[model samples]
Target: MTKDGVDTSGSGQQSGKPALHSVYSVNNILHKVQILDGVKVTYSSWVKLFILYAKGYKVSYHIDGTKPPAGTDPAYAKLCEIDAHVLQWIYGSISDDLLIRILETDSTTYEAWCRLENQFLNNKEARAVALEHEFTYLSLSKYESLDDYCQKLKDITTQLNDIGSTVNDQRLVLQLVRRLPVDYDTVGAYM
Candidate 1:
């Protein structure tokens, strides 16, 4: 038996080799990735983290749209089994609202992945405009702490850059200074 108490003695297969089912752990993934709530985390960042987990588990083919083996192929059953586990991971790591929006009947992991990507990324120009507006409206006076305000600004800029809007360092610095509270007049002047 391996760590999870599943027998891995390679019955009728290979000696001392763990079966595909025994190789992956569900808890390990959900712990590392925060639930993708769309507001708390950007879709691109969530996808990057999920890609890292899938790749590390050697199951990225399940979500990378790789064609599964034919039904008669020897490895077909194993692919189906592992893909089921991947589907579980996807379901477990999303918000209930998001789950309700994207859930489909009898979907393969690849289809689910595509659905999520399309939902979040299909309207890139619109998202960028909204994000730009958000960045413009962030005010240091609204946040009690200067650090919180700066971090929020940084996160929005990063999200904008990731979506290809390209917030240059000069503009970012200008925004940073422009949004400062009146109390930071000396500091803003130095910037």
Candidate 2:
């Protein structure tokens, strides 16, 4: 062990060079992470965040749908083992209903990931409808500030874009102008 209590043995070091040590173990960190609820509409940002988390652990291959090549190399075998463990971790991070749906068609982690993505991320029509409804029903209350209202509008627009739908800037601006309360008439007139 080094001064920092990092084990340097078998770290492939030579010439008395300092051995590298991982500051955090991926499994340790991910074990505490919660799974995405299957019943709810999973957002793109949530999915992206999960992918980023998996990338931190160097297990993003499972999501990218890549398969290990058939080989006798021990390194490949070790990677396969790691992939399997990561796959299990991913499995543990999903709801039982969703798990069963994916398991019916996929035997590999990559496939399972793809299946989930397809099931959740590909429903552009439903997402677009929901975003449209949100946009249509959005109203600035008497208690809400103009800045806050505008931010909410922008957020909805962004969500629309993320789900393969878009509201043009002119339309958004027009909506903002139309939705302004009578108290903001002077500001509206100035625009």
Instruction: After superposing candidate 2 on the true structure, give the runs of residues whose Cα lies further than 4 Å from its correct spot.
Output: 1-24, 27-42, 53-56, 71-77, 88-107, 142-152, 189-191
Tens digits of per-residue lDDT, candidate 1, 15-41, equal 446454543656555696879887677
lDDT of 1 at 75: 81
Each candidate's lDDT (Cα)? 0.82, 0.68
Give all candidate RMSDs, comma-separated.
4.6, 6.2
| TM-scores of all candidate predictions against the true structure | 0.84, 0.59
Residues 1-191, candidate 2: write the lDDT tens digits. 46765556865455556533232345443455566563232445556776777777666776785767767765686666666666676677777777777775326677777787776668889978987887877778832577888887887787787677878998898788787879878877877
* Model 1: CA > 4 A from native: 1-23
TM-score between candidate 1 and the true structure: 0.84
Highest-lDDT candidate: 1
